[model samples]
Target: MALTTGQHSWWRPLAGTALVLMATAVMTVMLASGTEIAGELANRPLDSEGTATWGDIGDTALALLSIAFAIPAVLLAAHCVQHRPMGTVSSVESRLRWRWLAICLALALPLVLFTVAVQALMPAPAGKSGDLAWAGTPAFLTGLATVWLLVPFQAAAEEYAFRGWLLQAVGAWCRSPWMAITPQALLFATAHGWGTVWGFTDLVVFGVVTGWLTIRTGGLEAAIALHILNNLVSMSIATAFAGAFASDDTAADMDWAAVAIDVPMVLLYATAVLWVTRRRERANGTDVPGGPNTSPPPPTPQTAAASRPTGYMDPAAEA
Candidate 1:
């Protein structure tokens, strides 16, 4: 179980590079197929507006697929190669509890309310010209359901890989909690890319908050819950504003001010969730049973020395 020296610095970056390359290959294949399909099905040449819509949908699909398959597959392969046990991948069983669910909801509510309040304060963005004649259509519902199922899975997979497996691996290797956490947060943010200044900023802050939760709780479950909640909230808001904002350009119409206000609320909720869970752990005597509140005592010099081998030599023989 001992971490090898230099493993911390090298293992994560190498794994991440492999994952990214695999995802790139998968996306390339998907895109080439899509291109062939589009060429064959060109019933009518898409206008500039249609092209924008196509791009948005294509990008979303590709991103979801990359996270859903590519990253998790790579991490699982790495875990197998390292001979690391499956138990170390995530701490869900330790952290998942009804009380924690209550706390997560309590934390999410204020942020949701704040987002609503801010949206109320701002004028609705200009509406897209076309009727979403597709709004209540069965096809729309089917597509939406498909997206809901697939998108959450994609998000969860990322949380498992980055916050779960990678976090634990790095923590073990570095022998420092913060060293494991900082890199995960940075990588999480960078993965979102700098598509828009506001969105990128939001993701960076979100990454820090989630990373803190992972480190504080010694698990990915809480962070995963928070991430899923955040994404669901954002998606719901986007759906509501779909008609009000240009459908093809929703990112440009994002309520950055609202997002900024909601971010603090998420942090507050995360802290409250951690505090409540920790308190419960102490009350139930689970802290001693390896819950979040438990901290192992520092290694003493004698203890360290005891772990090393000792050798005896005869003085007369040496002479």
Candidate 2:
């Protein structure tokens, strides 16, 4: 949902953003920087970018956990700034619709499978095998558990930050959806660091699609669903084919023609998710996307008692 009037104050968003950045920075560095590699790891020079080791997996999980706190930051920010419920920055319903999130996740399954299948078809160079047998090992299972549990929180935290907090704040300031999506998407891509042209393009494409999905779905459900499943698929494939403990960077040049095909596929995937979202809304008789039902629903007693805002009204407005 849109940020309400007076959300443009610049105080809340700025404060929340500062706190999130500082906290995530300090925590992630502490989590990732200190772990000593054991004899079980495939030792490499400290500077070489290669497959992951046991220590790498631990660092990655911890880093993802660091990013996951944005969800709490958002709620606290909303309350402290506007004294409004979370719905003020969420969808028209004024809160996260758990049913919609579940349905979107179901819709995302095929997309995730397709992505993994495509990556599988891409050729992997020699000397890059990540002990495919490790998939059956206890160590791999432990990594799998960590990824399955923490990765979703990592993805959700990003969506809530870019698509939830920053998106609505920008929307409220500029009073236009374009402003909301463009800068936030740019920030998202930039945060991931530089890569090859195709790789950078891929992030941009993903950023735009998820931004548009946030606008279309009026909540983080569709966006979060897409993010969570995509990361899960990426992690699983890396574990199965490449080393699960690999570094996040690449050094040598590789052909990206296969990745090029995925750009259009991302747009198609986003469209499919949105189509499902609108379809669900239509079945419920809302059809808000194409119609003028953008007006938020009236807040009920449940919402009032819930200590979260579900509508685009400032708590002070009601006061």
Best by lDDT: 2
Model 1: residues with Cα > 4 Å off, grouped in runs:
1-63, 92-110, 113-117, 124-134, 137-140, 195-198, 240-256, 288-319
- Steric collisions counted per model: 0, 11
- My TM-score estimates for the predictions, one after another, are 0.65, 0.75
Best by TM-score: 2
> What lDDT tens digits, residue by residue, belong to model 2 across residues 55-158?
55666775678788777776666666655665656665667778778877887888678866876676664545533544446656777788899989989888
Error of 2 at 201 (Å): 1.3
Alpha-carbon lDDT, every model: 0.53, 0.65
Q: What is the per-residue lDDT of model 1 for residues 54-92, given as tens digits with 9 covering 90 to 100?
A: 333344555566567644554454454444333334443
Once model 1 is optimally superposed onto the true structure by TM-score, how far is the C-alpha of residue 314 displaced, in angstroms? 44
